[model samples]
Target: MPAGPPGKHNAQAGGLGSVPALGRPERRAESLAVAGLQPFSSVDFPGRLAAVVFLQGCPWRCGYCHNPGLQSRGPGAGPRWPELRDWLARRVGRLDGVVFSGGEPSLDPALPDVLDELRAMGYALGLHTAGLAPRRLAVLLPRLDWVGLDIKAAPTDAALHDRITGRRGSVRAVRESLALLRSGSVDFECRSTVHPAWFTDADVLRLVSELSSVPRHVLQLARLPDASGTARAPIAWPSAALLAEARVIRPDLQLRAA
Candidate 1:
């Protein structure tokens, strides 16, 4: 029951269902390449207890990437599905659900297969994504128990967003995903990390207000220079003054240290 790097627990070594393969199982998804795994987490999925599965590969090259190491598709390619399923099999009784997070979980063409395998085992499925592809999101929506959607920038700020993401039109995909989630039956929320240098007080407030129609809209105060993920150089963020302004306009916000 100890929580540490994966070696501590093998939830699926010999259990109810056999471990699944981490390859191209889902015909609709991109592929199944795993980067890392966390056996247990209380914070990742709100109230539910669950395990965190980190998927590898991402198309976006965000400068502040926390997991820059996992961005490459070719590096971690191998038979990953079995490892994931075996690990989860070991955890069947203890954990309530699974959280698929990543360099963008939807990028994997084989994700639907992985999800189906998890569902077959009676484990609830959750996902954390940047909302890169609305079409793919539509595919995963029905199977999702909950989703933590990260909105990086506003739709209007294309140039700034493109600069931060090193990709054009990504903002549109993110926005479309947001709208899709809002209308869906799934329990979901939109969370934006307020990295001060990225946007001004006015920008953040406007963005928050725009998402007000969503049942759950959270404004996260971003922390900088944290090398744990793919974060690179430090950037200047807004002070308490801007944060306070956001608190007033945004109804529900999750503030983190910046």
Candidate 2:
């Protein structure tokens, strides 16, 4: 469940369709449009062995998005929610958790209900998001067990962030989400996917400094194109000096392969 593109998804925009109001359990469970499901994942939900649900539709269009197929709001080609639910029902105690990933899981109004269902079924819940919809996240906070929030760029560098996300006002939403997470009881972490072409050493340091209050911040190196021969640009890995300086700014910073 890697961070996907960010953009608003709604019925009018050809997204999954009209979002049902919160607390409407009758419709919420059926509203989800799942793009795919990873039956088992050890890395997605931190300590828990979990299943990752890839929801459809994201409003942003980051150039580095690997799941381009998921950026649209239309009906997906994967199993329907009911089918996935039935599948998960079978996993019960075998899986420790269920991670709602994206195409920005927060965009779907039904997410909270879906989380409710999963939690009731005895599975812990986790979310992966870019914080594009802070209000939605606020509603979801109480339902989540852990969250992996993506920090696209330094808070002050909105322009750079907009360029990466292909959308304006993203930084403001991310800031709001960060604030909410800071004040809440839920366990969470901030992560950044760094592509050397898009960020400099100074930028990384600044981003880390902005997240000083956060207990954990992870820096993930952008992935290289797969063997399918997709024409992705070559990646220049981060410099050791840059990583060292970032650690100085945020002593708890962790590095990982994307």
Each candidate structure's TM-score, on Cα atoms with residue i matched to residue i, is: 0.80, 0.86
State the lDDT of candidate 2 residue by residue for 152-226, as single tens digits: 998899999999999987789999998999999999999887786788778888888988788688887776465
Number of clashes found in candidate 2: 4
Best by lDDT: 2
Q: What is the C-alpha local distance difference test score of each model?
A: 0.70, 0.79
Query: For residues 1-258, what per-residue lDDT tens digits would candidate 1 score against the true structure?
Result: 111222222332223234554343343323477666666788778778998777777888876565666677752432256656766766788999998877788877778888988998889898988898889999998888899887777667777678778998779898889888878888887767666567777788777767767767666554445547644333444556765776677646665431
Who wins the TM-score comparison? 2
**Which stretch of 10 consecutive residues in model 2 shows the poorest summed lDDT?**
8-17
Candidate 2 ranges with C-alpha deviation above 4 Å? 1-25, 224-236
lDDT of 2: 0.79
